[model samples]
Structures are given as structure tokens and as C-alpha cells.
Target chain A: MECSVARTLDVIGERWSLLIVRDAFYGVRRFDDFRADLGIARNVLADRLGSLVARGVLERRQYEARPPRYEYVLTPKGRELLPVLLTMMRWGDRWEADDDAAPVTLTHTTCEHETTPVVTCAHCAQELSWGELRTDPIRVRIPAR
Target chain B: MECSVARTLDVIGERWSLLIVRDAFYGVRRFDDFRADLGIARNVLADRLGSLVARGVLERRQYEARPPRYEYVLTPKGRELLPVLLTMMRWGDRWEADDDAAPVTLTHTTCEHETTPVVTCAHCAQELSWGELRTDPIRVRIPAR
Candidate 1:
């Protein structure tokens, strides 16, 4: 199988693809609703919806017959992507929010308190993110010159 | 600027880029260490290192004199990417980790308790992660559609 990160992005990173998924998370499942929320063209929304449904991230159910309304619901596989999307929202909140207030806030369902998420290393267990560490791989072992 | 999510990925999602950054977060700097940890190829690692340095995500500082060894350090700009990377790790832990013992775990610095981060929408005060919210652009007027 492809690397988890790459595979995940490959499925999610097609322009407007993530936004569509985001809408599903928000309970906007109708084609028109997705179109309206994203300001995306009908054709693009149609294509994304079809692809997402095909990918098993979404399940389509017919709710109306006259106009044939359908709703998109997240499967376990789709729900699994929540962390990735949350990461994006956090990033947007930190860097893109126009004010002191976060563009989004995360609350623990159990404790019901506003909280911040952190990343730590498995080895040293340091809080990691951008500036916490440094990395690069070099080739050609240098001989004592 | 570009859509916040897309722009964020552009910075974090170059091939093997996030992993390299992940290593950095682990305090693995220098060429050989990264090579050892990631098993990345020479050329690919080299390219990623160069690009990250150029993007101001990392800085090259000589650590030795005889052969002039160098180590990559995270800049403030790079430091800001922490939350995003943390989110990614959280996602990986949830969806990708195989055992109950996740590849990594998050701990709240202040509370000193293992915790999970969440993303909530700014406008609605609803958690955006876990497929709970969707974004609305106010209108469906396509820019490039």
C-alpha cells in the first residue's frame, strides 16, 4: 500500500474535494447544499460527489422522488478523516483567523472544555510541531578530511 | 492569499516533506540522522532539505569545522506549523495506527494529562472535526469554476 500520508492526501487533495467532505461533516449532504456552501460550480460539485461516493467515504440515499433528492452521509472510512480535516481547521484558525479568537475551537466531548491539541514524539516525547525540532538526511558519509 | 487549507498543505505536503518535518519535530537534524530514520533516498532527501530551508521552515547552521557539519533548525515560521503537524499525527494515530498503543500520543502541557485535540467551527461554536460542520462561502459564485 502507498504511504498512509500520501494515500490520504491523494484521496483528499483534489481541489474542492476536501471542501465537499467538510460539508458532509457539517451535515450538508444535498448536492445543492454543497454547491451553495462551497460556491463551487454545479459540475464540479457533481463530480466530487460522485467520486466521494465511489470512494466509500460517503453513502448516498434517495430521500425524494419527484426531484430525486439525495443525501450524503459519512461512513466509518469517511469519519476517519476527521483528524486530517481538524488539522486543517486548526491551521486555518492559527494562521488565517482574522482576530484573536480562533477561526475554530476544539472542545473535548467528555470534559466539555475548550482545549488545544498537541503532538509529541514517541521516543523523547517532546511536544512537536514546526520549531520544536530539526531534520534532514544527508548522503555520502564524510571521511575525516 | 490562497484558500488557507490549500496554502497550508502546499507548505507541508511536498513529497516526504511532512515526514521530514516530523523527524525534525523529533529533534532529528543533520543529514545522516534523517536518512537513518526515514530511509529516504539521497537525492530526494537533499531536495527536500533544500526546499525546506528556502521556505524558511528550516535553517542550516554549521555544527562542525573540519568537515563543516550542518544541522537544520526550525524557524519561527516553521514553528507555527506545529498545530497542523500535531493534527496530522493525531489523525495518523487514529486511522493508521494498528494497535491500541498508538504510534504516538498527545499530552496536555499544562494539565499533564493525555488529551485529544479537537477542531470547532468559529461561527457556529460547533466542533468542526469528527464530521460535525461544513463551511459556507456566503454564495456559490465560482471564481475558477
Candidate 2:
């Protein structure tokens, strides 16, 4: 797809993929840990992990040599997905959570405050909401069939 | 399921659901329009639209009366998902896009500059990155078996 959202979804759009990435952020590196934490089927987890690695989101490193064990770690590209996941968590906490309190809270290490992630304009640094932004179609290049 | 990100994924984690929402941000309203844009299966699109409407993200409003035609519009809750979508787009552009230029750019209407959305701590307004944030587990309530 030409749209960036579609392209991103092509890589990590599925619930399992994002959930696995979430688990990775939680520092669940071993395959068994991901399967245990997510309760995902072994085949599905394997497939997602393989795809993520192939897509350069996760790096597979041999952690043990005797039994030939591997661990999945987020690459730089995968680490950059933190904002996407953080924003989703914030949205879910606001709209989907059962309780008033967030199940988990993010602490900004630099400022030492319980923080809510807000999307801000990189140029003016203004916190942006839906109303404060407009889409500027820079160029729409129709893909050649 | 306890994680808000997982909860949010329970709602819109599917690729098609997010694609439809992305199209909504692009001002797509009609069923035909969504179908035309995404080339998604009609039944799947119908199912997704129905679920989104049921979830209060998209509202179906009567736009034509000749044969009871309706258009899907983003509700306040749906509009709140813009940041989620924007962050994903930003991530995709950074990693997935083959070209340097983004297919579309968001302009901060307040600042009138092409903007990149950055996640920031709401309290101190400092730009947040993965290393600068730490996840604190508040509480985990076990579900009754």
C-alpha cells in the first residue's frame, strides 16, 4: 500500500505481532518467555518472531551454545516503535481500561514524573490533538500497476 | 489482557480495522469509498464497520434518504485514535517507506509547519524516548477463574 500506515501494518499490524513486540519491551527475550507471557500458540509465536526478525525489527542472537538457544532482542528500528506502542497503551488506558487507574504507568526518567504520552509537533513543540493538525498532501504517487 | 495496549488491540488491533480508521482520517466516509480504497473483502469490511460502530469509534449517520444510505464518521473517541494512527504512520515512514519523502505530511495547524509527531511527558513536557521512560507496574489484578 502507498500509505505509511498500511506499510507499517504490513510489518507489525496483527494483534500477535504487536503483543510480541510489547512482550519484547517488557524484556521477555527467550521464546518460551514470550509464549508463556502471551499464551500464544507455539507455531504462531514462532512465525511472528521469525517475521519480526526478517523485517529487521528483532534481532536473533545465539545466547547459548550447548543447547543452541536463541534470544530475540529489539533492533534499533524495533526500539523506535516504542512511541507507537506507548501511544496505544495510553489510548487503551484512557478508553478501554476497567478501572480509573492505569494498570501500569510510565515514569519519565528524565523528569521523574508519572507521565502520559502526548503527541507533540516536532517544530513548535506544541502538544497536538486531532483538532490541532491537518493533513498536507505533499505528493501522492500512484503506484504503477 | 491486563495491559492497556492489549486491551486496545482487542478493539482495533486487526489490520483492516486500523486501515479503515486510517481511511476515516483521510476523510473516507462511504462504504463504497472504503471498499474502493482498501480493496478489502465486502463482508470483512461490513463486519469491521459494524464492530467499529458498536465500539463507539465510528458512528453511522444517515447521509442519504433515497435508499437509506449512511456514512461512517469518527466520533470523539475515534478522533482520539488519531495520535495512535499518527505515531504508527511516523514509525512506518521512518522504517518502511522506500522513499525519503512521506506520502503525506501532517501540518501543525497552530504552527503552520510540516510536523513530526513526538511523544512527550504530559507533566514536564519533555520529549520522551524508550530509554528515558521506565514502566512501573502499578498492580496486577488476577481475573477469577
Candidate 3:
């Protein structure tokens, strides 16, 4: 549980939380739109939204003053999650999809082409495959409580 | 829900499922090791393991026959999830970790250097940032039921 991955899961590990982030990436901002797009119960959606905002992944912004209406927008931290979602989508498209085209394609605006994302080493810039990577245990300098 | 991300979530969406996969990457193969490391309910661990196997993420192998002992190993499909897990861990290390060093470091075996993974477009090989990509809806031909 002390692992970074475990800590990450502690924040946005639940199905509904990740799905909410996915919906936000799709430009879903309104409560009704999120509920309709996800078919999630109102209470569940509200709770997840609250947690995401509290966790600093989503920020609540007021879009209307008279009705006191607001929308949830992805924070920088939440926006950084695109790689995680995109990688999962790539895996699903490769392994889980039926014998049909992917339901959505990601276009790299910089390159003007549809793209599949691959993980690369930041230092060497070599594309990583499963066999090319290994984990080394590092001593975590735990602070005195 | 028809999107690949949704489908991927349907398979490994649960927190425990992904955690179990994470542990497998860290070389926790035995059921007891997983139970101890995760501190998860026995029934929940068993259920998630069963689902992962059924979903082709993990393969069960009999390591001992006398008492019918088995271990779960990641299949090729499961190994491909390294990017997803690595990306999440990187996010957590960057944003969620306390004032401590990362608990583990990934090394690229080919280059013999510590690695931070970045998502890169397979076509152009450019590292993707949040604003550099956009999703476009693609028609998936639904199979006749």
C-alpha cells in the first residue's frame, strides 16, 4: 500500500471516479450531461464529483450566477491523467474490441494524424516494451510523523 | 459505454483488480502474498483473481499438485498493461506522494538507466502532452446480434 501506484489508486482508483474523469475528458461539464452519458445514479455522481474536487483533480466553476449553476472542469492534475486513460483505451482497442473499428480515434494535433500512444523512456527516449523494463526497489525516505 | 476505455474499465475497472495487476508486476504471484500485500478481503481477492483470469489478463498455473497449489501469472495482454500502471505511478509520484522518495523505480533493461515513462504518438514518435491531442468519434460497426 505504500507504493506510488497504491497511493494513486487511493485517490482515483474506483470505477466511477475514473469514469468521471473520462467523461470530463470528453468535455462533459454539467451534472445532467455526466449522469446521462454515464447512466450513473445522481447520489453516486455527486459523491464522486465531490471527492474529485476535494482531491484537486476537478475544480468547480460557476457558469451561471442567477441559478448558482456550476460545472466541473479538470484541473492540471486531472488533465495529466490523459495518458493513463489513453493507454487503457489503446489496450482495450487492441484486445477487447469486437472485430470492428475502434469507437473513437485520438488525433495528435501537433502531427495532424491519428495516433496510438506508446510509452517511452524519458531519458533514453526508447519506446518501452514489457520485456525491456524491470523494477528496482528504492529506499523511501519516510518522514518522522 | 461503447468506447474502448469503458470496455477496458468493464474488465479491470475495479480498484482491487488493478491493484492485483500492479502487484503482479511487482512479482507477487502467490495468493497469500497478494492477500498480505493488499490486505484485501479474501473473498474479494479470489473474486478479482477469477475475473482477471476469465478476462484473459492473468493465467492460472498449477505450481504444486499434491495440495493443488497455484499461482497467477500475467499473460501477454496483462503485461501490456505496464504502461497504464507506470503512467499512474508517475502521476502519483509527481502529485500524490508525501515528502518522500518514490517507493520504487523502473529501469529500462535495454538502456540500463532509470526511466520515467511518457506517452508518445506511435506514428510521429512525439511525446504527447494534454493539449496536443483530441478525440474524434469514429463509427464502430456493431455486429448483428
Error of 1 at B84 (Å): 1.7
Better of 2 and 3 by DockQ: 2
Clashing pairs in 2: none
Candidate 1 clash pair list? A25-B131, A26-B133, A26-B134, A39-B140, A129-B82, A131-B79, A137-B31, A138-B31
User: Highest TM-score, which number?
Assistant: 2
What is the CA-based DockQ of model 2?
0.57
Worst 10 residues of 3 chain B by lDDT: B136-145
RMSD of 3: 5.2
TM-score (all chains, Cα) for each model:
0.58, 0.92, 0.91
Lowest lDDT 10-mer window, candidate 1 chain B?
Answer: B134-143
User: Which stretches of candidate 3 lie above 4 Å from their native place?
Assistant: A138-145, B138-145
lDDT of 3 by residue, A22-45 (tens): 888767888888887788999999
lDDT of 1 by residue, B1-145 (tens): 2345555665665557777775675677789888876788999899999988887789999989988899987777676676666555455555555564435444554445555545443333344444233233322223334
- Alpha-carbon error at A119 in model 3, in Å? 0.4
- When sorted by DockQ, best at the front, the candidate numbers are 2, 3, 1
- Give per-residue CA lDDT, model 1, range A23-69, as digits (tens): 67666767777776678988878888888788777899998998887
Model 3 per-residue lDDT tens digits across residues B1-145: 6778888888887789988898787677889888877889999899999999999999999999999999999999999898888899899888888885645788899999999999999889988876788778632222223
| Backbone clashes, candidate 2 | 0
Candidates ranked by TM-score, best first?
Answer: 2, 3, 1
Off by over 4 Å in 1: A1-56, A60-73, A76-83, A89-145, B99-102, B120-145
